[model samples]
Target: MVALRGVTRTVRLPDDQELHILRGVDLTVNSGDHTAVVGRSGCGKSTLLNLLGLLDVPTGGELTFLGTPVQHLRDSARARLRGEAVGFVFQQFNLLPGRSALDNVMTPLLYAGGKQFWRRREIAMDILDRVGLAHRARTMPTMLSGGEQQRVAIARALVRRPRLILADEPTGALDVDTGQTVMALLDTVATESGAALITITHDVNVAALARACYRLETGVLSAAAIPTGANA
Candidate 1:
């Protein structure tokens, strides 16, 4: 569902030096696959996620989705592609403070399909139920707990039924038990929807849930073989 070839992103520092965030990164993800990107801060993990989501363009190399070269698309075209093909979950829930959980989750559907607008509420409710947040549907983000808010975010990400899911530090704000619950919910949603999932996390336990895992360090991405005792 996603591929990157020799992708490199560079930024100029005030010191007149170039900082290479991603260096010759080559990666691919297929339908029904789950990938975990493990790295410390400033290791280009989020940069890689942004590239996959088409939120940012790489300075060099090719990124393709469903066989289309994403780098060649126009800005409006890229936005349309993102709305149709991608969903994103972040460490911060990013819900509107005044909106109820149901309303927040339905926001994605508004940009998804014009004909599906009226049905967005129902779809949002279903996703909330799937994420075990049906009881909090009418609650506002401030009134909900951290885990609850993240669950609402997950519901929003799933409401569109996009082909791919990009999650960056999704469980970072929650406690251990809550993080585990949220991760499991994410895993279940991706499996049920048949959408390829890519998660960037610093936690080793969280990374173990994916079918394939990789670590980013020093401008390189390396794959790891799964062991029999990986965390579920």
Candidate 2:
């Protein structure tokens, strides 16, 4: 679980201007919960995702992950925690060039060590199957269609069975039907594993699937009413 209180992320531009990306954002995500954040472009959705995933530290306020204050942890400790608990699904799929679907999914386990490292291939294959990509395990990203590539990315993200799943516009690059199927797949898999799912998207249809919803604009976050299954 992760919690943010009065969190602010400010970036110093090259010209020495301070650009505030997140301002007074307060949110708490519990285990097994499904949450969605809807925002327009340039509204800090990605910034919020980065902070939640431990890719960046906030400029002010507090962020706690699994009851530990992120600010107090050493850089090494924070990274270890992130690798062990966080899974990210990007809009672009972010598959490594030249790697087969199976290889891409196995990349995460290479850092896992012990039994996980030794069983990386087996584990990756299972996840690929879970995403219905088992048959395409040997296929390269360029050879796969957009939907197939996204499925591969999903398989990679879930291979670790992370406790928190952060999906940033996961279906943004897919066609409507493909997006719907992929989003449903991601939600189902994350829920089955009891991982808290936080989807960042601008699509109301996407937001409708979540148990709770929020609209983020101009660096501020607030609860928004979204009828469950409304746009599904």
Candidate 3:
């Protein structure tokens, strides 16, 4: 449901020089597609995510969402579309400091409008249950363990059943087993809902969960082969 062709992002430095972030990147993600983007730090992976999430417009090139050119959309329209169509999970968990798990999850629904807003509590509770956090629904982020916090974040992201899920370094703070479980949860949820999943990570194991993978380096994106062990 997303396409990018020759996408480029350049930032103007304080010195008045241009710094290229992404150059000539091409990508396509359809419903039910699981795509992984692997890159080292400062390789523009986050920049690409910002463009896909509609947080930033491409400096140049064609970027489209559901066949509509993103560059042509206004900030308000972009924000509206992003709220309705996309879900984001970050490595930091980014939970509200003082909100309970349930409350944090319901925050998105508050701005979602219609049934989602009216039934926010029920919807949020159901998703937390699905993520196996029903018992901790009242727990604060500080009281929960890292794995639990991440699960809560995932539940929050999925509370509204967004059509696209963007996870950036989702497993960074968890142990191997916890990381595996988190990735599995994301894959299963996306598959069941027919939503596309895009994971941005440096770990090959995390990237392995995706059906297709790409390596981003020096602002360029290219097809990546699943590692030998990843094939198993």
- Tens digits of lDDT, candidate 1, 106-186: 998887656678788888898899988899899989999999999898888888888999889998899878888898889
Least accurate stretch of 10 residues (summed lDDT) in model 2? 223-232
What TM-score quantifies how close candidate 3 is to the native fold?
A: 0.97
| Cα-based lDDT at residue 105, candidate 1 | 96
lDDT of model 2 at position 162: 95
- Taking the tens digit of each residue's C-alpha lDDT, what string does model 3 give over 1-232? 9999999999999999999999999999999999999999999999999999989999999999988898999999999999989999999999998999999999999898788889999999999999999999999999999989999999988888999999999999998789888999989998988999999999888988889999999999999986433435
Off by over 4 Å in 1: 226-232
* Candidate number of the best TM-score: 3
Instruction: Rate residue 16 of model 1 by lDDT.
Output: 95
- For all the candidates, what are their Cα RMSDs to the real structure? 1.7, 1.5, 1.3
Model 3: pairs clashing at backbone N, Cα or C within 3 Å? none
Sequence-dependent TM-score of model 2: 0.96
What's the candidate order when arranged by decreasing TM-score?
3, 2, 1
